[model samples]
Target: MNFANACRLTLLAAIWGASFLFLRLAVPSLGPIWTISARIGLAAVFLALVAQALKQGFAWQHWREYLILGIFNTALPFLAYGFAARTLNASMMSILNATAPIWGAVIMALIIRKMPTFKVCLGLLIGILGVAILVGFDRVVSQTGAALGIATCLSATLCYGIASAYTKLKASHIPSFQVAHGSMWGASLFLLPLFATSQPISTPTPVVWLAIAGLAILCTGAAYLLYFRLVREIGAASTLTVTFLIPVFGILWGTLFLGEHIGSNTLIGALIILLGTALVTGFNPLASRK
Candidate 1:
């Protein structure tokens, strides 16, 4: 990869990684439903403007598909993470995000009615072990609602896995940008009623508004654009390297900005999870270089 693409990859990771921090900052005041609603709502607006600027129009006929994708891919997972952010540290949530591919492999295997390969099975086991270590040993476990938060985050990753499998099964023909843009709109609509019915626990201060903007614009909207560009230029596998990089930035941002402590379990669990992910995806850095 060229130095510029490499930098883009790192920047993408950093932006996405910082999403957890934004969630942690924003969710307390806005609450999960409102936080995620505003996030998808604002991101939809941003992507709409970008789509217009690029003269790309939506395929309105595919609104049903977009709704399904939006619920599974955007709305559910974002809501789950937003809920979890209230109880879990940004670092922990980021590490848990890495489990999406593992869940994807399992979902795919079940969908095809075939067993996973030995490597994948082993990776799945190792990944579970890593999550156990991370959650069981972490200091957060003692906090109220932490267990539920962990479960919520895991459910979020499971939603991502379901979305991936669903895309491959039903929506592969749709362009990536269209899927992203349409889904944000879909998610916004999905969450609109929920946001309307629910009230924020506290009024949002300016900093909270800033956090919401960062989450919506930088982390969700711009990050998707950057991710798709990397996919086009470097192929999906190399672009996926961003997955491994995300948790590193997640932990760093949590530590540096939020003053969240990273115990040894965090490091050990993250490494194990990434190793399991590498095995499951068969992602090799050396192969990408060629």
Candidate 2:
């Protein structure tokens, strides 16, 4: 927890937090498929240039691995969250996204054939409770995007969590930068046909291009670099803490820039979700051993 890593944490939080806002802006102009495609495409190009400059030529040794990561981590989750955000508020979407660690823990347990630590199991239960509290009552009491939007957010997180477990396993042998670059390029390729069908360029604007640029340079490129650095400096648990702060800035930007409303339920849900994340990432049954 050095001062420098702390600052990096804050920077990563702000950058990712603002990602939802960028999506919101770009989606209106370009639609979800195109907006996401543009970002991943641009990010791939930028990362490729950087890698070449650093003498890291494109490595296709694990093209299959990168392709899977791209599909799960980049394409599927991005589209799910993007479409979901059209209906769900930023705060709510972020709250749901925070459940990634819980999903990760569960996936790990399943894949590794080892019992999750007690604390991890408990954290999973608590996280589920929080999601229920957030979405259950809303679904029962209202018809305002409670089902579709919430489902999208949770599904997106599920993809993220599964991808995370896979990344942890595969990235053990792959160069981290190559992983990032390959994932971006694979995502771009996956989205290309969809982008072609939608064809956002048919009705483009300068603002839309700017949104794509921000998504590419800031959210995708810069964010991934800091993400890796933060993981190294703070460990995965602390690095993922950025997820908690992302929603705060996302909600703020949504309200300030997009004029989106912040509902009372959304705020309550956010608090509960943060509590769940804290439990999942910070808790350890074996803490006494340390």
Candidate 3:
């Protein structure tokens, strides 16, 4: 990656990292349905404005792909995260989020009916180890709601994995902006009934509203711009490294803003997870052997 792209990558990681913090603040108040629905809904509106400013237009035929992505990628995953945020700290949530690529590999293996490379198999195992270390250290298994929260977080990442594979298999031809915009709308649609039934809307404090704005506008909408730009400028493989850095900033943001614990075990587990993901995606130069 060039210096500019490197900068963009770092910014993208920071934005995504902050997303966990936003969820930590907003989800409990808004409830999963309203919180996640507002997030994608507002982000879709922002992206639409930007698209109009850029004189860009997309075809309506991509509705089917939008629905698929909306369900697996946006609606389901965001719903899971909303449930998880009630108990999981921002740092812990980010660590679990790193498992998406590992899940993606497993999904790909199942879809293809073939074994993954040795490195990939090793990565998958280490990724599991990373999760074990975290859950063990946190004693999430023993906690009441925390265990279920962790499970929801894992399910959320699994949804992300499914979305990635589905995108590659069926919708790779669609433009990133279209998929992002349409999928957000799709997710909003999916969450509409849930939003109505889950909770009555209440006036949020100013702080909560700020968190909502950041979550929807900055974390989701603006982050997509940086991500898509990096994918176009650098190869997607290079852009993928941002995933490793996201947890780093996630921990940092949690500590600085929310005063969440950033224990040694959190750092160690997150490092292992990122390392395993690097191996899975061929991000490790030292492990590149014939």
Candidates' TM-scores? 0.99, 0.89, 0.95
Q: Against the true structure, whose TM-score is highest?
A: 1
Alpha-carbon local distance difference test for all models? 0.94, 0.79, 0.86
Tens-digit lDDT track of model 1 for 29-104: 9999989999899999999999999999999988988999999999999999999999999999999999999999
Global Cα RMSD, each model: 0.8, 3.2, 2.3
- Report lDDT (Cα) of residue 85, candidate 3: 88
Candidate 1 or 3, higher TM-score?
A: 1
Q: lDDT for model 1, please.
A: 0.94
Off by over 4 Å in 2: 136-146, 283-290
TM-score of model 2 vs. true structure = 0.89
Best by lDDT: 1
**Candidate 1: minimum summed lDDT over ten consecutive residues — where?**
281-290
lDDT (tens digit, per residue) of candidate 3 on 185-204: 88888888887777724667
Model 3 residue 55 lDDT score: 86
